[model samples]
Target: MTSDADPRFLRSREAILNAARELLLESGPTAVTHVQVAERAGVGRATVYRHWPQAEPLLVEAMATVPMPFLDKPTVPTREWLRRELTAIARQLDLDDVRAVSTTLANTALWDEDMDARRAQFAGILTTRLAAALDDAQARGEITLALASQDAAAMTIGPMYYRSTIERAPADPALIDAAVNALGTWAAG
Candidate 1:
């Protein structure tokens, strides 16, 4: 009978993922080699490779484990929920691990078929969530004017990305509030 305490059970896929996440946070994607991950995880290089043959997929999986922000549709109204949700997203964007993942995605030179597919999947997740939030807000009469959910989402998230990547500045609560207010004004106009 196989014991649950076997070494295989001890070093599960999650252990590998955690080790990879740490490496990505510390040294970026380029440093996430199989040997390096094995050293960090205290596992053999062969074991790491056996679990994840390529580095990009492994990194992508590690990144996916990082929680993406989502706004819960509230029975009250969309505007209130959006304000809360955008604030949360802004706060999450300030996290070092989140910034590291964004930086890694921007710098990855592997633009092959697999990477393209993965990028599309990642984008879809963001797009869908943003759309839902905007729709909920519209339904609640929070946004008075006609604006596409996609555009609103872009406007809301773009500044956060700019501050995180281009400016290399931490996201401030005041800044997020300002963005939300601006969006609300535009909608009301």
Candidate 2:
């Protein structure tokens, strides 16, 4: 259905969305009004409001653009792979865009049904990737065959989220190592 929209119309809409995302990352939701988006997008306010009657939908869409990569297999030892993945997460969290977008998403209460669904969808994609990484580790004799892929995926993300959000601590690589080791998070199944 969306694909049936006019090419020019769709392009304009994308410009508005991109503008909104930039504003959000630069100054939070309050600063990203439709008028501001229109100005940044080089379009009219009516166009922005026509597409997004409210800013919440725009905010959610903008947030969907935030980049989040999943695990890349390390040479051997699953711990090493976990180390690299977690370290990369920590590094990404350091970016302003990541912080702005993630802060909005991490505060669960702020999510509407659409935002929640989008967030879940992205999480599912990441989990699938995590599953692949876990499968690889298991194949390489680093992870145990008995471990559930979904559980392993959760194990990989949950702590990093906790450290970055509630704990108000950096998701340092060393901290990741310690936390996983302490939990025995992925211990032989």
Candidate 1 has which clashing residue pairs, if any? none
Q: Report the C-alpha lDDT of model 1 over 80-124, residue by residue, as the tens digit.
A: 566677777676667665666566565562565655666666666
Q: Model 1 compared with the native: what TM-score? A: 0.63
Provide the lDDT at 105 for model 1.
62
For every model shown, what is its TM-score relative to the native structure? 0.63, 0.62
lDDT of model 2, residue 91:
69
lDDT tens digits by residue: candidate 2, 1-189: 245378978998999989988887787556677889999999999889888886656776886786544564345566666677777777666654455556665454255676677778777777777777667766666656455776765676677776766676677666777645642345553
Stretches of candidate 1 off by over 4 Å are 1-42, 45-57, 65-69, 72-75, 185-189
For all predictions, the C-alpha RMSD in Å is 7.2, 6.0
Best by TM-score: 1
Candidate 1, poorest ten consecutive residues by summed lDDT: 67-76
Q: In lDDT terms, how accurate is model 1?
A: 0.68
